[model samples]
Target chain A: MCIEHKKEDIMKLVPLGDRVVIKQLVAEETTKSGIVLPGQAKEKPQQAEVIAVGPGGVIDGKEVTMQVKPGDKIIYSKYAGTEVKLEDEEYIIVKQGDILAVIE
Target chain B: MCIEHKKEDIMKLVPLGDRVVIKQLVAEETTKSGIVLPGQAKEKPQQAEVIAVGPGGVIDGKEVTMQVKPGDKIIYSKYAGTEVKLEDEEYIIVKQGDILAVIE
Candidate 1:
């Protein structure tokens, strides 16, 4: 089940079945010492904001419910999700289990 | 909190918070047509068996409980967990969200 949410002009996508759609937080382009890093030199950020949530359902006969919702900021494994493009924007679709923590 | 379980002679490790300790499943050493593949040619398996689990607790004011427990076979993100060694054996520690599906 996909859940859609609107954030400004961005078309938010909702994930299904213990899945979450995340918009990655942008990394700083400049170093603390003021040197600007090239795009290729920067690693993908693990931090993201939860844009959509899936309704947790049963898997392998076990009932699972989502622990996160839209608008929650989260930290996830670096290579967790499948990258997708929507509305000319990049997003990630990750299982709930791939999320490491919810950032306060 | 960490929970320990023993399987055969293996010293199992329990994870903390939403963490899970997993033993990765071995991949096939040969192809379906009978060609043997070298160890380095094989990709790390994504499927694993749960050996230990941590008590789900509050994170960022949210009460989170674990949806998985010991003995559940699961599929997770390929690069999801941190690799660790114990008793000369390799294991992985992954947060619950890294798990994709529990295999029946």
Candidate 2:
């Protein structure tokens, strides 16, 4: 469920299957016109950065490898993924398919 | 966004990126006790058969490939994919990562 990265003291989670752990991008609180948006007015963030990737393995005799790796910014479906909190930090665990595109 | 398959008269839809087109498995209308369950009582089918697959291409410099091909039975997340209607046939467009497992 959770894996510790030796390089960083922060605990890293290892997602299973084609799942990827990501941190959601925060929505802007103010508009360019200098108008502050209410919490309810802000849309759900669909963009996120990949924190960890699952190990691609054989499923039903087919080999599945991960496409995106750590530090990759990605766009995902609005309703996809499971939310989790670690060390008071929020994250989402989503499958690679749920990711729509990788942002360069 | 729709592609035609030459082999079958049925028009095959090609999913983009890691997307996959699937036909949901029908749920049993009758219970094991022989009681007829109402349509609303039936749970959403999570199992589906792959109809067509997308040509996985470059994403953020990563070359992702299709893991499951046509005719493969798979189990997907309950809320994953978008429902689509084609030729009066209902189908779902889901990402390969949304697929939990391939049923053998």
Candidate 3:
């Protein structure tokens, strides 16, 4: 999903705590073994666009401030989040800590 | 190692960021099939005593406060930490977030 994916659709799925909901910007991925990898191959996607961000608050006894906002392009660590399915759309819910960098 | 293992000796090692150094509290562990597991086995030990705690401060752009102090017996997630052998004494360094519960 990109910036034009409609904020209203993403707002339907609210994240809890310091979690952020993101949709992968996928590309046809190929593995080092010369095989086409599956969509969920883990290596397939690390880049995403933020769909929604949780309200920053105390999480696990630590003050967390959500640094990334919706529509921000970001890169997350491989295998960092839980894949969530909502209404036929797949989203990855990751803690703010799992986000590696913003793509600017 | 327990608190009786000498706090002075543990002080030699200092953890960085929100990491905590811990030593496993071991027992003769058996697998689901009833085979005794080795000391390094992941299922063998989950209980640990805090050997050292890092100073509370900003880590990874997040403010972290060290909650578990040295000598606090805690239960950590299995396979959660990096094992370090400092001067022949083995210790596991884990982020405080990986600590599950403290033993009262």
Best by TM-score: 1
**Which DockQ-derived CAPRI band holds candidate 2?**
incorrect
From the highest TM-score down, the ranking of the candidates is 1, 2, 3
lDDT of 2 by residue, B25-75 (tens): 876578788987645456776889998887777533457788999999999
When 1 and 3 are scored with DockQ, the better candidate is 1
Q: Lowest summed-lDDT stretch of 10 residues in model 3 chain A?
A: A2-11
Error of 1 at B90 (Å): 22
Give candidate 1's TM-score.
0.47
Q: What DockQ does candidate 1 have relative to the true complex?
A: 0.04
lDDT of 3 at A57: 79
Question: For model 1, how does the per-residue alpha-carbon lDDT over A13-37 read when each residue is reduced to its tens digit?
Answer: 7677778999887755676799877
Local error of candidate 2 at residue A102 (angstroms):
0.8
lDDT of candidate 2 at residue B10, scale 0 to 100: 55
Question: What interface RMSD does every candidate have?
Answer: 10.3, 9.7, 11.9
**Between prediction 2 and prediction 3, which has the larger TM-score?**
2
How well is each residue in B1-104 modelled by candidate 1, as lDDT tens digits?
A: 23555547654454546788788877658779998775545676688998777678853335778988889999999877876544445567787889999999
